[model samples]
Target: MSTVGLWVIGAGGHAKVVLEACRAAALPVAGVFDDDPAAAGRDLLGFSVAGAVPPPVRWRAERKRGILAVGSNRAREALATRLAGVDWATVVHPSAVVAPDVVLGPGVFVAPRVVINPGAVIGAHVILNTGAIVEHDCRIGDFTHVAPGSVLTGNVTLGRRVLFGAGAVAIPGVSVADDTVCGAGAVLTADVSSAGIVVGVPARAPR
Candidate 1:
């Protein structure tokens, strides 16, 4: 397959990180696209904001492959799902350590110093942020965000759209359901269901 040149869909801080990752991988980038009028013509890491992403027709016309660089899980999912025909780029920073047996779906973004161990299954559009450690056999669902410095112990499972916050730690074999958001610095000792936000040590859902 031909190496797809990246055309980033968002021009925010997250986009900058993706651009850097692409550079680290020695992948070429076409440019950036954002809906914000003010962001148009702006430069992200020396790459110009080409223009607003046109309709599917225009995207097809250009034949430009890209990736959703949006940080928000919902926004990334919406954009990626909407432009399903667009070829999405899976970006991984050079500093990240992904085991050979790990499975990463399309549109996944793995940031600097991230460590994904053997047998981990990372779904589409998942963000494994900087310094995060995903242990053996961890399962992260689509559009989930594993925030910076977080650690998921062996066999941990995270459902779709879940957000594991910065510095949070989940114990081995625990499962967090879809859309659950764990707060920064939280230490999860048990499973967290889809209901409510979780914070603090031994992370619990506050009533």
Candidate 2:
């Protein structure tokens, strides 16, 4: 890693947690940048939020490290892809229990007390929120957010841009398609092959 500190992109609630995780991991955070001009000069965890992010070329030339801290999967993916060549920083909270063989992709966030068992494959820019448990061999796709207290049993597969909501659980061997939204506290007992919101104890689209 470069001696220079990393920059956090976004100044929302999720950014707060990301900043804390970075601090807990002892990573120097340069500052936070948000597109919202109003966010500039506001205090975020004692750091000032800059009005604008550095240009993509500047990030490349300066070799700046950055992480996307937004909660929305689509927005996170957009911001990440836009900043081509920026060295994406992977952040894992100090308390996270990630297995030695877990394959974590660039810009992944493993939050406090999260457990990723061995052979799990986490894709780029994924967010494993606080206390989430990903059992062995689970495959998580890019920009997916396994929200706080969620659980994925062994061999569960999630597609890109999926939002496994807070406290949701997926039974073993289930697959969720891209862009699907698993509602908070929902349970997936089978496959979700469509992109839409699923809710209830055994999750299904509300129709």
Candidate 3:
């Protein structure tokens, strides 16, 4: 296979992790871009900051294959839509366990110890963080983040940009709505409406 030139879209901590994973996977990292102009010309893991370029400009240039490293699902989803014409790479860490029948979309990241079971469909720019468990037949929408140690039970449907906080758990067949945020250690047992932030056991909206 030809060498892949990787252009990361963020410069924060998550971008650092993704850069390291890209290096470990032997992909050539072309550079990184951040919205903060001060972050430009800085170095991240020996890769120099390549200046801030909007998704449209970057995609139009087509300099390198892109990866959405932003942690905010809404931002990621918007960027993914804007850059739909660009080639985005899916990244799976070597230690992630993805079943043969699992379908992963472009720019998805499966971190180490992540488990994606059979028939799971993960959309573009989604992040399955470390040790996250995605059970069979689950449909994870674009740019959703399944945080470290979180669990999504079988047949769950997660809407775009939904964030499950660290160690959160969702029951089987539940549907989490778009832009919803499930707080750390929350247990979700029912459907969540769009744009809601739910926390605690049974996942009620925050007071």
Best by TM-score: 2
TM-score of 2: 0.97
Tens digits of per-residue lDDT for model 3, 145-196: 9999999999999998888899999999999898899999999999996778
After superposition on all CA atoms, what RMSD does each candidate show versus the true structure? 1.6, 1.2, 2.1
Candidate 3: segments with Cα more than 4 A from true spot: 1-3, 54-63
lDDT of each: 0.90, 0.93, 0.87
Give per-residue CA lDDT, model 1, range 1-207, as digits (tens): 454477788999999989999998998998789988999999899998987876666667777677789999999898887887877778899999999999998899999999999999999999999999999999999999999999999999999999999999999999999999999999999888665699999798876
TM-score of each: 0.95, 0.97, 0.92
Ranking by lDDT: 2, 1, 3
Error of 3 at 167 (Å): 0.5
Cα lDDT tens digits for candidate 2, 41-77: 8899999997898888877666679899999999989
Q: What TM-score does structure 3 among the candidates reach?
A: 0.92
